[model samples]
Target: MATHLITGASSGIGAAVTRRLHTRGDTLWLLARNAGRARELAAEYPGAHTLVGDLADPGRLSWAFGHQSPPQELDSLLHIAGVVELGPIGDLTPKIWNEQLAANLVGPAELTRLLLPQLRLARGHVVFVNSGAGLNAHAQWGAYAASKHGLKALADSLRWEEKPNGLRVTTVYPGRTATPMQEKVHRQEGKEYDPALWIDPESVAQTILLTLDLPRDAEIQDVTVRPGS
Candidate 1:
């Protein structure tokens, strides 16, 4: 079985993927900002281990990546962890933009740098669970859009760099998902974005695992998943 490390493992799609992979006997290393949440998730799986702290903090990220123990050999890394904040361009604050950038871009970039050795050893895959906002534009989704764009660029560049080494890099741009973060954004927008109409977390996990298990010739650089409804 493959070993995977994931961020934003406290909730949303990360949580779902954690459960799915754990049941399949895959070792998981979880990274998150909240110790309590990380511990809670760790408790759910017999061998699951979590690195509790903020990824935005370089020192903290160093601690988590360099210091934390994995449940098993660390292989793939699922960059599912992200942050979304909404406001019109005129009203958006630099603090918010920087915060999201730190969480959504720098954090993942730095963590991947730290874990590249292990991933290289396994010849593993790197999954970027980015948002459609990374590919499109929205009135108040400026911060999210910028961060995701950076994330996509990062994934693409790394994909090229790792091709000779036989590592697979995929970016899954999800349109809408029924996740806690989605709910938070929906509520912030003061609109009802039906969760039922949104993509299913379990389905996303299924797709990711399937893609990861595909034959060496079958490479999907990016997969766009939009809600059916």
Candidate 2:
């Protein structure tokens, strides 16, 4: 069985992916923000493993990982955890910008760096669950979009840098998924929430699985998922 590590597995798309993988008997190592969250995930997924590392504090991930045992080699590392805050650029504070950046961009980068040895050993795939905001910045989306755009850049550079080492990097940009994060976005925008109008998290999870199951002779560099009409 293939072994994988994933972030943001508590709910939404991350949870969807974890469920599918765990059901099929893939060994899973899930990242949780704290001890309580780790225990919760351990109970929820039964046999899956949990790692405690707060993405908001990217600087301490190494120290945090040192305290725990991570998988020796990984088939995939899914960077799916992120935080977002919506506001006009003028009204957005350094604190808001920093929080989003730390969770969305820098945390993923640091985590990948720390796990490169294990990934290279297994020729693993790295999937970044980005957003449509990464492609276009609308009003009130400046900070979150900026972080996602940086994520795209990170994925692009990593793909090239790790090509010879046999690491595959893919970024899946999903548009307005019906997630808790989307609900929060609606609240910020002062709009009504409609789950039917957005893409389902399970659909995105399937797309991710497709990339992972593809033949080793080919790779999907980037894919975008939009809600069906």
Candidate 3:
């Protein structure tokens, strides 16, 4: 069985992906800020592992991964955790912008950097669960858009840098997924939270699974998933 580490594993796409991996009998290290929820996942799946800590804190992230010394190298690392802060460009505050960037970009970058050696040893795949905002900026979503844009750039750079090492980097741009985060976005936009209008998190998870299941010699570098209109 392949070994994998998944961030944002307590809920949303991360949780969906965790369940899929668990059902497949893969070794999973679930990381999320919700300690109790992470434990809940662990309890539900006796073989699943949980790391409860905030990715925004480097110390916490380091400690979480350090404590879990995997007997085998990782086959995949999925960075599905993200933050969204919506506001017009003029209304965006430094704190809000920085925090979004930290959660969406910097934190993932650091965690990936720390795990590079293990990933390289296994020639593993790295998947970044990005958003449509990373491809196109919107008026009231300055902070979130900018952070996702940075994340896209980081993914592209990592892909290029790690190609020689046989480590695959994939950026998945999912458009308006149906999740708690999307509910927050809908509220911020003063619109109704309609799950039907968005893509299912499980669909996104399946796409990720497809990417991971590709032949060892082939890789899906980038993927964009959107709702059917």
Candidate 4:
């Protein structure tokens, strides 16, 4: 089992992945913005470790990782922490736009950069939990769309740089997951979104496990999981 470091470990897909890793008996390091929730999960699982930090402050990423009690000797990094800020392109405030970019795009990039030496030591993998919106586009998802697009591009470049170091990169494009983020979108869309169309969080975690378990010589370059009809 891989020793993994994941962000956004408190709930939704991050929490689901945490459970999957727990059941597999893997050591996990988790990042949560909220201390209460993080500690709650830490209490639930024996070896689950939590690091509290805000991804919105890109500069603090290195410091956050640096200050961990036990330095993360992570075999893989599942960059699962991300935020979706929505507003019409015309009215998208600069503050929200920057925060979204920092959290969803910059923070992940910086964390991977800071942790990559450790990952290289283990010949590990970096998994980007990208969104379907990252690959395509939406009408009013200005900040969210831009951040994910940046994420997709970053993953592509990292795949090339890190592949030679025995690092495997997998970008999973989850389509309209039934997480709190999706709830926000659904609320915004009102009658437009069908509840039947949202993908389950557990399914995303399962696919992540499957990707990680693939043979050393091979790689599943990408996986797109949509809700079942």
Candidate 5:
């Protein structure tokens, strides 16, 4: 069975993907800031383990990994943890910009770097759970959009640079989805949250599974999913 580690594993797309992987009998290492939720997930899935730490904290992340005593190699690393701070460019404070960048870009990049040795040994795949914002920015979403755009760039650079090492990188740009994060977005926008108007997190998770299950010689470099509505 393939082994994988997923960030933001306690909810939304991350939780959905974790369930899908667990159902497929894959060994999973779940990392989330919610220790209680992570423990709940671990109890539900036989091969699932928990790493409780904030994604933005490098030292905590490293310590969490060490506590679990994970295997030397992993078949996949899914960077699904991110923060969304929506505000106008003028309204954005340095603190908001720094927090968004730390969680959405820098933290994931550093974590990936830490796992590069294991990934190289396994010739594994890396998936970045980006957003439509990663493709284009919107008003009142300057900070979040910029961070996502940076994420997109990170994925592009990683894909090109890791080619010789047989590493695959896939960036999934999903449009608005029905999740707690989306609810927050809806609140921020003063609009009603409609699940029907958004893509299902399970659908996105399934696409990720499909990419992972592709033949070793072939790779899906990028994916974009959106609601029909």
Candidate 6:
């Protein structure tokens, strides 16, 4: 079974992916922000492992992982954890921008850097769960979109730089899924959240699984999942 280290495994798309992978008997390492969260994920996934590192504090992640034992080799590193805040450019504060950037971009980069050796050993794949905002920035999506755009750049660069090592990188840009984060976005927009109107997290999970299951002869560099009409 392939081993995967997943961030944002507690809820939303991350939870869906975790459940699917666990059910398929894959080895999973779930990243949590703290010991309590790690315990919670460990209890939920049973045999799955847990790592504690706060994505909001990217600077401290190296120290945190140094204290814990991560896997020797990783078949895949799934980056799905992210934070979002919505406001007009004028109303957004430095703290808000920094918080989103840290959680969405910098944290994932640092985590990937820390795990590169393990990934290279396994000839692994890295999947970044980006957003539609990454490609197009709307009025209120400045900081979050900027972070996601940076994520796209990170994945693109990693794809080329790691090609010689047989590492594959992909960025999945999912549009307006029915997640807690989406609900928060709706609240910020003062709109109603109807689950039926958005893409299911399981659907995106399936897409991710497909990418993992594809033949080694080829790679899916980027894919976008949009809500069906």
What TM-score would candidate 4 get against the native?
0.94
Residue-wise C-alpha lDDT for candidate 4, range 130-168, written one tens digit per residue: 999898877888789899999999999999998889899
lDDT of 3 at 11: 80
User: Per-residue CA lDDT of candidate 2, range 1-229, in tens?
Assistant: 8999999999999999999999999999999999999999999999999999999999999999998999999999999999999999999999999999999999999999999999999999999999999999999999999999999999999999999999999999999999999999999999999999999999999999999999999999999999998
Candidate 3 structure, TM-score to reference: 0.94
Off by over 4 Å in 1: 70-73
Superposed model 5: Cα runs more than 4 Å off: 34-37, 63-68
lDDT (tens digit, per residue) of candidate 5 on 2-67: 999899876889889988888878889887676687778778777677666676766566777666
TM-score of each: 0.94, 0.99, 0.94, 0.94, 0.94, 0.99
Error of 2 at 59 (Å): 0.5
**Span of 10 residues, lowest total lDDT, candidate 5:** 52-61
Model 6 C-alpha lDDT per residue in residues 53-157, reported as the tens digit of each score: 999999999999999999999999999999999999999999999999999999999999999999999999999999999999999999999999999999999
Q: In model 3, how large is the Cα lDDT of residue 139? A: 91
lDDT (tens digit, per residue) of candidate 3 on 1-229 = 8999998876899889988999889998877577677778788778887666677775567777676654357899999988887888899889998889888888898888888988999999999999999999979978888889999999999999999999998999999899999999889899999898889999999999999999988889999999988
Write one digit per residue (lDDT tens) for candidate 1, span 61-106: 7766456664434568999988888999998888998889998999
Q: After superposition, how far is residue 81 of candidate 4 from its true place, in Å?
A: 1.6
**Winner by lDDT:** 2
Single out the weakest 10-residue window by summed lDDT for candidate 6.
Answer: 209-218
Our tally of clashes for model 5 stands at 0
- Candidate 6 overall Cα lDDT vs. reference? 0.96
lDDT of each: 0.83, 0.97, 0.87, 0.85, 0.87, 0.96
